[model samples]
Target: MQLRFLLCLCIVGALAQSDYDEDDGAEGKKDPKEIQDPRGHRPVSRGRETYSAGPAAPPPISGGSRYRGRPTAAPVGKLVLEKEEQPDSGGCNHMSEKMGVLCPTGCDLKKTVQKQERNVRPTVDQLKRSVDELTQSTNSVYGYVLDMTTEVAQRQRVSEGNGLLVGQYTDSLETQHAYIKDAVDITFPQNIKILQAVLDKIREKIQRLEKAISAQRAKCQVPCKVSCPIPVVSGKECEEIIRKGGEESQMYLIRPDPLGMPYKVFCDQTSKNGGWVLIQNRMDGSVDFGRRWDDYRRGFGNIAFDVGKGHCQTPGEYWLGNDRTSQLTKMGPSELLVEMEDWSGSKVYAQYEQFTVQGEATNYILAVGRYSGTAGNTFLNGATELFGENRTMTIHNGMMFSTYDRDNDKWIPGDPSKQCSKEDGGGWWYNRCHSCNPNGRYYWGGSYTKYMAKHGTDDGIVWMNWKGSWYSLKSISMKIRPFFKQK
Candidate 1:
């Protein structure tokens, strides 16, 4: 029995040594060359068998230690071995205190996971904010596009309405134009025909009235058988004749220069027979001697001719001499009258009348008749006649006023003591038989007097002399008829 107890004791000792060996091998000091991880842990070497700190391992019950302390739970989803406890190295222990964990390696994992969560939260917030901003921008753009579309639609509707209104107005205008055009086309010709017919009847009535006036004028002319023996007919009888006969009975007879060329006279019965109907009150200051001659010869002043400057001192319808007293005188028993004036302030009046002897009209004679006025010592001293070319004559009582006896160019008074002498008998008026003093000499030589005797008289102007000087007449008046030849 004692021998069996000894063997049993030996077996027990052997088991205790085996346990101590296992513990020492696992939890003993490590080699100096083995570096620790920054997490305060060393990995098991690949050559050694390591125990996994898995969930399958349970904590030891209270007894001689299978583990020195309670086993820490393994980190989730990681395969890790429980590290053996060593003496407190200041580096890993200090790191563990800062990390707030016993195992620095595991503590590092927790801190890394926390840091990732911290980083991810801000990223998530940034992403959320960006999404909101994008949503808001998209909404704004959509609203703008919608507003623009609405406005465009409204404008398009208004444009369509305006187009329709314009088309309606155009159609209305076209209808009105067509109606007016058709009305005008239908009535214009009928109105024209009615106006033409009325005009034709009015013209026929005018022609008949003109014929009746002609017959009355012819009857009135027959009563005035003898020529009117007056320079101008005034009074009630002349008014009655003019009223009864009217303008139709009035006629103008013109005699142009160089007697009986072609008729140079034109008559405008509508406008005072041109110049034939001379009214003293109608005279304006402006005058042309050549035009007056043209009007006297042609009854109109349309013909142009140059009247030399010295022929007229001033332009007027008539030229009255410087002296005031002058009168128209009837030269014979004929319708014609001659203008007589004594420019020496002698008032001499001559009378004349017209008559048909034996029913034959004598050649119109213009002769000196009688002198009445203040007669000076110079008897019939100076006389001048201003008549147009056609009305003037060179022959007076069959004696030429222009001719002079060439033997006596100068005049001498008839009585030496009486402003007259026989030596003054050189002039035509003194040599030719006349009522004046036979011994007195007369002076006459001028454009009208000298040239008319040779050229047969034209441009009626006469300058007569008595004693020895030249002078002008005061006034002249005459009536003339203006006529144009029948075409």
Candidate 2:
């Protein structure tokens, strides 16, 4: 009986102690708003930007602090900006002027996380892009080699078509002239007059087919690239380029045959119905397909090519003609359109035309004369020329800003402005920044590189296999040495 009485008394004492502890603990609980960080600072998010970092000690709330009825969701540091002008002693009495070093640049402290993320994203993406460019080039080699051989063969088969076409036209002209001279053949001038009318009608029809060629040359120019993947507009507004996009557009070389090597080409020419072509050759015994793509915004299609070392050719005239439907896609304030040939001859043929639109007003600004040539002709000495004349303008966009070739084991530079921004640790460079997608695809201006790095490209360039051509965007431009073939 005495043991049971003692146990009941002990239970009553324990209950009293428990109640006392609960009341005291409730009073001591953290305010829940005050937070801590490893840096011994409290940062408050202000809007999307501003942040104030203070020492470990809690900051004092001043009359300057504005409460939005409800407590702010952003960190207290954000509200601290207004305090920036005030001495450090105003916020957390413990902080010293040294802590003021935490002041952020124009960049907001809130951007810290985002900034770090950007840095990592591009490095990884570049690696993958480099690999893809390698694969693309390999495939392009096969296609380019085949194309080179085919061009040579085609030239042989139709070796005299150009001359034949000229002769046919001249013969037709002569036949008409003969009718004019021999009035007895028709017993009157009416026969000659009738033939002349027919000829005029035929000429008109032919002129319509050659409108692209005529319109461009009549202006003392050819189609040119007027724009590239320019910087994004500052705001939601868009803008178009006012001048041509291709500057320093010059010859590059390629080797299409196993035994063939690069040569320097300085002269090439073509006649009406022909189009512009650039034939390039590489110093290294390899072949590159001769397909040129204007920046995506001004989508110019493929044209005749004579891609070999030192290959330089004037635009060519053409005889065959076909109608094609071109497509258009606008980028930003400027409208970007792509006009490609629906049907063309063996040598890839296309033209790049650029025009700007403002309200309802439109102005044609630039055109790129495209053509191709190869060492495929006997008379032209195994060299085929792809020519275009319906364009003339200064077009330059330093694409191919970066390129790396495993075969050459070297990195080349393109244009600095196109590849990167001046802000980041590494300023802009052509080959490294602009040419291909940061992923190593051709410069379609689709994908963008991530955060700017001090030295972004390990290999220092991006190479792309576009269509059947291997194009390189180098980072550190040394010599743009390309060669033509001897086959």
For residues 1-487, could you state the per-residue lDDT of candidate 2 as single tens digits? 3564465446544554555455447757544444223243333423232334454333534213333344335464444443433444434322133334333333332344354445545654665586678779989998999999999999977877888888999999999889876866665767679899999999998988799677768876655652222122111111111012212223223222335443211111121211112222112112221111222112122222334433222212111000000111122111111111111122222122322222111111121122232211111111112122211100112211111211110122233443232211211122222221212222222222432223343211222212211222321111111111227
- Compose the digit string of candidate 1's lDDT tens values, residues 186-213: 7677778888999999899888888888
Candidate that would win on lDDT: 1
What's the lDDT for candidate 1?
0.34
Candidate lDDT scores, in order, read 0.34, 0.30
The runs of at least 3 residues in candidate 2 whose Cα sits more than 4 Å from the true structure, single-residue gaps closed, are: 1-350, 353-487
TM of each candidate vs. truth: 0.21, 0.14
RMSD of each: 33.4, 47.9
For model 2, what is the alpha-carbon lDDT of residue 55? Answer: 49
